[model samples]
Target: MTGYSALNMQQKQAIAQYLQSLPSLVELDRDDGVGLKRALGNYWGQFLPEEIDSV
Candidate 1:
């Protein structure tokens, strides 16, 4: 909660949205781990850019 406590509301919401975008733990276990990791990275990358733009 150290860094998390420092985040603004929009930043927090963006992170929440990113978490929502993630595959469930069960899904991740069932799928190709490497591929799912890559997709999660890409998803966060896309989310971050838009959040930055808004700032």
Candidate 2:
């Protein structure tokens, strides 16, 4: 995992919440999820599957 691990739990929680809430803000297709993952990686870093599972 990238900077995600470095972030405090609250920050991770915020990102998780934002990602979770995206479905309410806009229609989410598979590509949207992929794109979001990429964006998060670019902005933060890679995420381990277990780390993502926590989010």
Candidate 3:
């Protein structure tokens, strides 16, 4: 929890109440039968400033 805790102690504290329900949604993805790891957060500047498909 070091990575998350460092960024948002207050936010982390708030979501702590729901810790008991932290089951993996990926594990329950019945449609695909093979769940994929979805990356969280916005990467506004990680790659190119303009996307070819942005048009």
Candidate 4:
């Protein structure tokens, strides 16, 4: 398996938290698809709370 799959739950959670802490597109001036995709991929399986994601 690739190194990504080897990440432990805690590591995943940390990544998620880091992602969640990032500024939104408007705030960061990163409204492009590539920027958004990069942000999402950086956190992979991590999901934000519904309220936040819905915004």
Best by lDDT: 2
lDDT preference between candidates 2 and 4, better one: 2
Q: State the C-alpha lDDT per candidate.
A: 0.59, 0.65, 0.34, 0.61
Score candidate 4 by TM-score against the native.
Answer: 0.46
Q: Which tens-of-lDDT digit does each residue in 1-55 have in candidate 4?
A: 7886888777766776665565552455546546656767765535543355564
Query: What TM-score, over all chains together, does every model reach?
Result: 0.39, 0.47, 0.23, 0.46
RMSD of candidate 2 to the truth, in angstroms, is 7.2
Per-candidate alpha-carbon RMSD to the true structure: 10.3, 7.2, 12.1, 5.5
Question: Taking the tens digit of each residue's C-alpha lDDT, what string does model 3 give over 22-44?
Answer: 33432444533322112111321
Error of 1 at 29 (Å): 2.1
What is the Å distance of residue 39 in model 1 from its true position? Answer: 19
Residue 1 alpha-carbon offset, candidate 4, angstroms: 2.4
* Residue runs of model 3 more than 4 Å from their true location after superposition: 20-55
lDDT of model number 2:
0.65
Tens digits of per-residue lDDT for model 2 on 1-55?
6755678866766776676567679888999878877766675333322344554
Over 1-55, each residue of candidate 1 has an lDDT whose tens digit, in order, gives: 6855788778866775666566663455545666656654665344454444563
